[model samples]
Target: MRDAQITDLPDIREIYNYYVANSTVTFDVDAMTLAAWRSKFYYLGKLGMPFIVAVSPAGQILGYALVSPWKEKRAYRFTVENSIYLGAASTGKGLGRVLLGELITRSKAAGLKEIIAVIADQGADASIKLHRDFGFEEIGRMGKVGYKFDRWLGTVLMQKSLK
Candidate 1:
């Protein structure tokens, strides 16, 4: 994994849109435009946060992982939330594990205290397992807190202490 560049936005958006359209992994209902994605990249860069991507040998972007502040409150400054996405073809190849491992390392280097993953309760076993492998433990569960795909969705809050 390495720092993502502006040129990688298209592939990133494509992969993300796929998830948006078909999965509960992200609650966003609409596929984001290139302009919006550019703004997201710029904001993360300005925040000095890491936005890293995994690429295939042929240079295709296979997946990405990023961390952002968990909340806007001053007291929550030390906590960050993480998200990860892998191309359908890239799943089960250990790419998510690799990306998450690097994310944890970057979070530690940034002096963050915690990495929280808000996982959709549906079809998130792999994600929960991945976080557990990195030492994250379930903190809470908000039942039926989200509605998506014509159904109610639950969320599981998992966190790992980085300090």
Candidate 2:
């Protein structure tokens, strides 16, 4: 895994858009534009958030993991929300686990006190197990909080204390 570069945006968008269109991992309905994606990169860079990408030796982007502020309030400054996405071919290769582990380590080093993962309840057992393996515990569940693909979706909130 390595720090992501601006050049990696296209591949990142591909993976993200795939999940957006076919899975409930992300709540976004529209595929984000390159400019919008660049804006996100800029914003996260400005916020000093960690954005790491897993890559093959041939320079293919396999997956990415990142963390951002959980809330905008000052009191929540030490808390962060994490996201991880794997390229279609890279799933179940232990890459997500490696990326998430690195993310948590870096987050702790950055003085973050907590990391939260908001996961879709459907077909999310792998993510839930991954987070649980990293010591995250289920903290809350919000039923029918999201609507997508003509159905209501539930979200499970899992958190790990970094401090």
Candidate 3:
């Protein structure tokens, strides 16, 4: 994995939009346009967060991982949340774990003290397992906090310390 470029936005957006529309992996109901996607990445860059992607030998983007502010408050500066998305056909591969592990390394290098993964719903077992395998512990769970696809969904928070 490597730093994401502006040109990689299209593939990233596509991978994310797929998860948005097809699953509770993300609570966002609307798929964002390329411009909106670019704006999000710009914000991450402005925050000095790492946004990395894994690519195929032919240069196709297989997956991406990023770090974002866990909260906007000053007290939360040392804590950052993470996001990872893969192409629909790419699930079940070990790529997500590798991508997230790289993000953790970057987070530590950035002097971030805590990393969190908020898995959207129980259906996202793979994500939960990924974070757990990396030594994250389940910190909390919110039930029916999100309404998507005509049903209530929950979120599980997993945390790991960079220090």
Candidate 4:
């Protein structure tokens, strides 16, 4: 895995948009255009967040992991929220673990004190297990807080202390 580049935005968006269209993994209801994806990518970059991607032997991007401010307030500067996405074919192959582990390492090295994972309760079995394996614990859960696909969804917030 390596730091994501401007060129990686399209691949990352493809992975993200799949979830948007096919599952409750994301609540975004609509697919993001390339321009909007670039803006989001630049926003993370401007915030000094880590955005990295995992690639296959042939240099195909398989997945991505990134972190952003947990909250906009100054008090939340040391804590960040994370997101991870993998290609449809990359699931259950340990790529998520590798990508997330690297992201955690990068966050710690950047002097961040905490990493929080806000995961969708539905279709999040792998992410829940992955974060658990890396020592993250569920700190809170909000039920029926999001509405999408004509149904309500919940979120599970897991956190890992980097210090």
Per-candidate clash tally: 0, 0, 0, 0
Residue pairs in steric clash, candidate 1? Answer: none
What tens-digit string does per-residue lDDT give for candidate 3 at 83-107? 9999988888889889988999999
lDDT for each candidate structure: 0.93, 0.93, 0.91, 0.92
Candidate 4 local Cα displacement, residue 138, angstroms: 0.7
Q: What tens-digit string does per-residue lDDT give for candidate 4 at 31-129?
A: 989999899889988877899999889989999999989999999999999999999999988888899889999999888999999899998888899
What C-alpha RMSD separates each model from the true structure? 0.9, 0.8, 0.9, 1.0
Give the per-residue lDDT of model 1 (tens digit) for 30-123: 9999999999899888878889999888999999999988998999988989999999999999999999999889878878898899999989
Over 4 Å off, model 1: none
Candidate 1 vs candidate 4, lDDT winner? 1
For model 4, give the 10-residue run with minimal summed lDDT: 40-49
Error (Å) of candidate 4 at residue 115 is 0.9
Candidate 3 TM-score over all chains jointly: 0.97
Best by TM-score: 2
lDDT by residue (1-163, candidate 2, tens digit) is 8888999999999999999999988888899888998998998888778899999999999999999999999999899999999999999999999999999988887888999999999978999999999999999999998899999999999999987
- Error (Å) of candidate 3 at residue 52 is 0.2
Off by over 4 Å in 2: none
